[model samples]
Structure formats: structure tokens, C-alpha cells
Target: MTDSSAPPPAPAGPLSGLLVADFSRILAGPYATMLLADLGAEVVKVESPAGDDTRTWMPPVRDEVSTYYLGVNRNKRSVALDLKDAGDLAAARELARRADIMVENFKPGGLRRFGLDYESVSGSNPGIVYASISGFGSGGGASLPGYDLIVQAMSGLMSLTGEPDGPPYRAGISVFDVMTGLHAIIGVLAALHHRAETGRGQHVEVNLLSSALSGMVNHTSAFVAGGVVPMRMGNAHPSLFPYEPLPTADGDLIITAGNDGQFRALCEVLGVPELAGDPRFARTKDRTANREELRPLLVERLKQRPKMEWFHELVAAGVACGPINTVDEGVGFAEELGLDPVVTPGEGDRAVPSVRNPISLSLTPPSYRLPPPALGEHGAEIRAWLAEPTTD
Candidate 1:
């Protein structure tokens, strides 16, 4: 639960006055719109009569609400519309036509028949920043659904996870979806900037496949430079050793000795100073070559101490080390470290807890001014705002 004593004062955030018509659903689109809302944009989440699929993705429900849906829909309003219904579709189109920015993750040509495609909407909303998120680019792979697991497999991300000798494993989180969302955010921002200069809008397209490839920066670099596809090395880095999780007496601790000096400090902290001077383990390259041999030595020595003990010792010795923590533990640890990562908005039956946006600007901090809405909760209010006569 989030702290609910008093609401934090709103910051002068970027996008403070922007209006976003969010026609996207599920993870990627909603996540991007959440970011916009965090920066103080008024996001209208346009959903179908059946609601977003995430609204039913449950197990951890609060007062019959899906926690999954609540997680990313914060600081926004919801308006239900059945696109097939003529009146509802017209309302949706009006919202998009008047919006400063419009985002959608519908399948390729899915909204075209309803006259909501970028080409159609931009015909009237010439200054709109239109953005689209998809599983793949609007080309050969556009017809396929954009599931995170499938993108992970198709983009070679699964190949670079897990143990080297084990079958490929998907990341526990929807990494591809998250990455695509971030990319969509970037595209929308860039388009907005471009519109400011040109006084005309353009279509911005982002897809899971491209995002996954971009997210694989370091791993892809290794393959492109060495002509060898990276194999899953589990927690071990391909180019560094003593950088993987080492077994401790109680649990596991990850050590990230990125440089020779850090490696030496780690060795001294582990009571194995001689290991740092050894010819086969002298430099980063040498450490990588002798990782298999060095791993066992570090593991054996680390096993003598508990994870917390080693973590403290390594930190004091200027070596990067952290205990492997679960999601709950990580959140708790952040709170202990004085990082307020959660926010509670308002006092109402529909109020929900939301995580603060990670990005921080000194003059423009992200906000949690509103809670996630109930389905069509703001339909009447938003339609009234839309129907009000515009001076322009």
C-alpha cells in the first residue's frame, strides 16, 4: 500500500498541459500513456465495451479490481466505446481528432475500417502527434499478435537468457512489452517536438521487434563484432567475471567488479588477495578466460559468509555487490534507502496505489495526481469537455 497521509505538491512537470487520447490497451500502450500522465498530461484511455484485457488479468484483485490493470493505468481517465457502434465510434474519433497526441496499439489496419487510422485522423487533426505501437513493423510480420513471449523468442532475447547448456528461457518480466512502451514514449515525444517546428503532424511507429533488438545493445554488439551469437551465460556476463551471482552461506549475492581495481578490492575483501595477482586472472580479459576456474574459488570462499554479511563487507571495501532480492524485497529496500517509489492518489473507493515514474527532473518531477479509473468512469465528463465549443 502507498503512503496516504497528505498528497505531495504537484511539480511543474513537462507535458503539463498536453492532452493525450490513448487508444492503446494492455501492457505496452497503457505503460506509455502512464508515463505521459505521470508528467501531468491528461490521458483519456479509450477502451472497448469489453474493457482492456488486463482488467481481467487477475489473482491479485482489490475489491474485485484487477491489480494488473491498476498497476499502469494511474493518473488517467477511462472512456468505454464500442468502435463498431456508430455513435460510440464517432465520439472516439472526435476525441482523437481534437487531441494533441494520439496513441494506439491496435493490429495493422484494425482501426482503418472505422476511419480512425493515422491517415484518416491526420486529415483533420493536422497538428496531432500520432503514434502506433505494434508487435512488428507494419510489414511482413504485422498480421501476427504482439505477445511478449513470442517477441522475446523471435528477437533472440530468449537465446541470451538462462544457462548456457539449458533450453532458452523467457525473462520473468514482460521485458519486450516494457521496452516497446518506452520506445513508443520516445517516438511520441519526438513527434511532438517535430510538430512544434513544422506546424504539421506525422505518424510515429514503434514495434516490439525493433525495441527488443535495440534493448539487446551489449549482447548484439558482442555478436556483431565477434561473429559469434551470444549463448546464455545465466547470471554471468559475457565479457566479465566475478560479475555473476556467487553462492553465500544463506543465499546468493551478485558481485560486479567491473575493473581491475574493483576486482582487487573484491579479492582482498574475500580474503583472497593472491587471486587478484595471479597471471591468469590479472585483467578483465584474463578474468573472462579463467571465469570457470575463478568462479568455483569465489563461490567456495563466499559460501563461508551469509549474503548480508558479504554484501556489507563488499560495499565497505568499494566493491559493487548486492544480495539477490525478490520484487517485494527490492521495493522494501528502496523505501529503506529513502527512495519513495510509491504514491497514493486521492481518497475514494476507486483510488489505487501507483508507482512513481523512474525519471526525475529537478524542475519537473513526475506526478501521481489521479488514480486509475473504473471502466467508463469519466465517459460523461469527457464527452462534455469534448462537446464544449472551442475558441480555435
Candidate 2:
């Protein structure tokens, strides 16, 4: 057997000394805490004996590990605790009481019975930054399970996706859950900063439905300001023409000619300068109004060239354009652009790569220090820590 008394490894990033008790399951909560872990936080993921549900959500498993589980769970330790058991519940509470931050995605009142709720833990650990993520708000919607699909359906997001005449479609990815997790991270960081200043903490709440609504950007604004519920326009932009993905000889290319100058440049590159000056397409509003008449012309021009050919020419001409690529292609493209999109976790095999956090903080860049843990892998270590007497 390995030497169990070896010192825990030192952290590599700025959040080196922070301890995070992650009592979340599935995507959103785990994702938020995983991001913190990536930045060098000591995240102790508390799972039920059955493990995170995503561990079983797979057809794509690597070495018997579910891709769904691997994707959001990097750089953390795991400790299984059956909260239903009094001993386990006490251990979980102790973990919370000692942690710098506590993250949970339990349904409203779900952990109250075990006294693991934020209110209960914060009652003693007043400095704990308690973050709760839910599907919807914890008010009237507290009891509802916050699935990404359900939130996408209720947040009017589905209605604004897909083709104009096609049924509402969910985004291929759980974008709402991802966004909610990101929002939660932002809130937690902000709360942590506040705590550092005042030596006090407060509850931070994030819900998928609210996050989805906020992420709607101008779509939600249009509805609120003008009573215009945005409808799906396929790959087209509601306010801009020639801003949609067009089919080319080889594949689809998105030509994002957002402004008049880009429109002129795009038209020039397409060998259709006259179209740029045409009375019907001279300005954004004009182009938007004349989209039906102009679309066929643009599509015909685009079809004559391969996507890469137009992509290169348009980008050279100062018009924003590129191929519509799949996830694999997107990752490769980011790599080509010198983004260094992937990072291998120090503790994981090559297959379990962690994507770098998009935020680039010059003073404190996020780092991938540890791979995701096996289920309850840190149970004994965490239990030992919890069993120690509190000094404060």
C-alpha cells in the first residue's frame, strides 16, 4: 500500500490555500466548483454513494469513465457521504463549517433536514461564502428540479432557436446550465472578495432560468421594450443581413458583416460591389428590410466559392467571416489561433484534458492543478479533517 501520511500536494495557482466544500451534483454546481478547483482551490466534492448522476450518463466513456462526468469535474477530490445517515450528515456539516466556501445545487430545502443548508452552516461559519445553484429561483420555484432542458423550455430560449418554421429546438449543449454555473462562479468570487474586506459572508444564489433570461441579451430587451417576442430566424441575424451562415461550394460559412463598412468590404470580396451601393441595401436598416431580395443574390455568390476561399478573402478584406465548424474543429481553430484552449490536468491521463478558463487574468491566471477524483476517493482524508476539533 502507498504511504498514507505523505503531505498533500502544494497548489499551483492563486487560490492555493482556499478550501471549497462542493455539495453539488450533476452539471451546474459541479461545473462552478470545478472552475474554482482549476484555479487551485482545494475542492472537496461530496457525492452520494451512487456517485454523481453524470457518472452514469454515458455512451462515450473513456476507460469506463463517462465523458459527461469527466468534462466538468476536473481538479477536485471527492468524498461520498450519505446525508441520510447521522454520522455522514455530521461529517458533511463539519466539512461545510470548515470550508472557505460552500457550493450546493440541492433543491430548495433539500439539505435543510440534514442541517447542511447554507443558513444552518453559515449560522456558525459566518465567514463562509455560501453559493446555491438551482434550476429556477428558490422562491416559488424552489421545489422544482432545475434541469437544463426544462429551463431552456421555460426561459423562451427554445422559442427563439432553430428555423423560423421548425419546432423549438434545444441547443445541442446544455448552454443554460453552463451559463448558470459561470454566473455562480462570478458571484462566488465577488462574495469571496467581499468577505476578505469585511470578514463576513452572504448567500449567493444562481438559477438556470434566471441566467437564461439574462443571457438572452437583446432578445429579452426586444420583448420587454417593444413587446416583440423574437422568433427563430435560422442562421440569420434578426437585425442584420448577410450576417448568417451561407452555404458555399464546400460547406457553410458565417459572414458576419455587422456594419456598413464590412458590408461594402464583403460585397467587394464577393465581386458584387454594386449590391453594396444598391438603394435597397445601402444601410443596415435597408439591408434588413430587403433581406428577402438580397439573400438569393448573396447565396448564389457564396455558392460559387468554397467556404475556406471566401473565409480567407473576406477576412483579408476586413469583413468578419469564417466557416461554421463543429466542436472538434472549433477546438482546433482555437489552438491554431494561439489560444492554447486545452490543458492536461496534472493528475489525469492524457484523455482527460481540461479546457482552459476563458478569463485571462494577468496577475492570477487560472491553472489546472489536479484531475477530477474517483468517487469518494478522498472520503477518508476529508473525514479525518472533519473529525478534528474546531479551534474557533
Candidate 3:
């Protein structure tokens, strides 16, 4: 960790002048704050002495530090403050008072008693963008904990996941937590725009349930607008034929023939061009309705080649197709395509690998200024700055 008792240099990105006081731990708030930090905001991560819970979440460790914690905490300074202590509380208050943005993920109204909630902080810095994230809305669900697994189960996501009749499974990643973080980012940016125009800040709120529902776009819309309750189809798309993985000689290859043209091409590739004109499979609706019958004919041809061989043929035919790749293979594929999927966020020996931020700007690209901080690694510097008299 950089152990200097001085503030870091000014950021050079689009959000260079912004200061974010981050009173969040775990995934959602930390993820949003990390993105802000990448955009050149100065982020001060406030934590209790025990530190972020993810610090102890292990099994995957890099240099003995929790990878889970490191993954979302780059480009930030850490300050450990026990809120129960008057001096620490004062320092936290000072940090919040000086910040232009504040983000927290405590349960609804959890920070009110500590005077760190939106109302309290905005009372002094009226232009601060205050963002709060929760699992459910702060309305009737305020008492529930904001666990991603619970949100996945409650948000109807798990219902749509898994093998058709098998037990529902949570996603390999905390999908809703990630979605909530992205939503929080959107809310904060919008609030910043509003503040720039009106010279006033407003509270920005995001919750996991709402983000999850919004993310289930096609599924939810099918029920609401079309009165169709969708169920798991075990990797099959409900409306499109040949949209699921098909067996090859060696493995499975996902093949999507989305239109009549693609269907004709696929039929040609299969050496059964006449099948494209067969009345039973002539159109999308007909193909979908006769999928059970059409499946075996396509399967018989696909089983003649290996997955990657079939993958190339299908792609060349202007049909979308690929073999499902493992995470390592996926990253390798991105690298092969010049996407540069991984990056190191710090200078010299301490640098660590990070997923490249997805956004691309013609100018003002995101930067990697700081490596993930160790627990209170910048405590001395942060506390010293917080002790100084505040102009705000």
C-alpha cells in the first residue's frame, strides 16, 4: 500500500474534481464507488476496524488478501474509523461534510442515528449527491437483509434459471448485486446532471429487487404485456427455433437461426437445403411449432462434426453460433480478438490484474490510478486530512 501522509495527486479523468465518501462494504456500493474512482473521483472508503466483510471472505486469495474484496475496491483510499468513538465519528463526519458525493448500502434508515444519512450530510453540503442501495425498497421490505442470494431467489431469477425441472440455482455471480451497482451508477450520474443544472442535489436510491426485475426485461414483459408466464426451458429460447445448444460429435454448440434467411443458410450448411422449404419448418412460427420434429433432422447432421468445426461453419454461414467457453477460455478469446479484457491497476511491483472497464470514451478514458487498498492502508493519510479544518 502507498503509505504517505499526503493526499494523492489530482485526477485527470472526466470526474477529476469529484470527491466520493464511500460508507459501503461488500459488493453493490463498493462496486459503484470503484467505477467512480476509475472515472477519476477521489474515493475515501470508510470502514470499521473489522474492515469490509469481504476482506475475510476467502477460498480465493491473492497475496493473502481476499480476491472478493480486491475485485471491487480499486482506486480508493481506506480509513478505518470506529463510529462509536467520538474522535472517529468526528473524522467520518468531516469526510462526509467535505465530499461531493456519498454512497452507502446500509439497511433503510440505518445511518440516520449516526447522522450520516442523506438528510444529515446534505444539511451541511447541500450539493452532495447522496446514493443509497438496498436489497428491496425502503418501503415494506426495509427490515429484510440485502443478501444477493436471497434477492436472486425472491426476484424470480432463480425460477428462470437451472435445468427445466431441477432445483433452482443462484447464478454463479451475484447478478442482482452487480445490477444494483450499475443502477446506482446510473442514479448517481443522473443526480449529478440534475445538480449541475439546478445547483441542488437530491437523494438517489437503488435496490436489488428493482434492478433484478428491470434486468429480467423479456421475461417480465412477456407476463405483463402478453399474459404469458415464462418457465425455464433448459437453455432453449421460448420464441426462436434452433436457438439452443445442439449436440456435435464431441460437445454442444449453441446455434441460433433467428430468421428465414438464417434458417435457409443453416439448412444449406447441413446439406439438406430442401428442409428449409418443408412446410413444417418454412417460417419462424412453423419451425417453433414443429421444433420437436425439426430437431432430430438437424441433430443428425450436427452430430457429423465436432463443436468447434461446426461453430466455424455456422458463423461463416452468417448464423450466430459458438461453443460455450469456460472463464479462462472466454478471457483468452477476448485477448485473441484484441479486446484486452484484463488490466493492472497500479504502478510497478504492486500492480494487480483487473477487468477492464467496459465503457470507451473518445477522450477521458477510465484510468487505473490506485491498486486495491489494504485494510486502513491509508489510515494515517486519510485521518490527517480529515483532521484539518474543513472549508465546506
Pick by lDDT: which candidate is best?
A: 3
TM-score of 3: 0.95
Superposed Cα deviation of residue 335, candidate 1 (Å)? 0.3
lDDT of 3 by residue, 252-297 (tens): 8999989999999999998999999999999999999999999999
For model 2, the superposed segments whose C-alpha errors exceed 4 Å read 1-12, 347-351
Per-model C-alpha RMSD: 3.2, 2.3, 2.1
Model 2, CA-based lDDT: 0.86
Which candidate order results from sorting by TM-score in descending order? Answer: 3, 1, 2
Q: Which ten residues in a row have the lowest lDDT in candidate 2?
A: 1-10
TM-score of 1: 0.95
lDDT for 277 in candidate 3 is 98
TM-score for every candidate vs. truth? 0.95, 0.95, 0.95
Candidate 1 lDDT, 1-392, residue by residue in tens: 12243356487579987889999999999999999989978889999989999999998998898989988898888889999998888888888888899999999888899999999999989998888999998999889999999999999999988887899999999998999999989988988888889999889999999998889999877778878788788788988887887889998888998999999999998899999999999999999999989989888899998999989888999999898788999999999998888888756765677777899888888888777888998888877777777776
Q: Which stretches of candidate 1 lie over 4 Å from their true place?
A: 1-12
Stretches of candidate 3 above 4 Å error? 1-11
Can you list the residue pairs that collide in candidate 1? none
Residue pairs in candidate 2 whose N, alpha carbon or C atoms collide under 3 angstroms: 135-146
Task: Summarize candidate 2's per-residue lDDT along 95-188 as a digit string, tens digits.
Answer: 8888999999989878898888888999979999999999888899998879999999999989988999899999999999999999999999
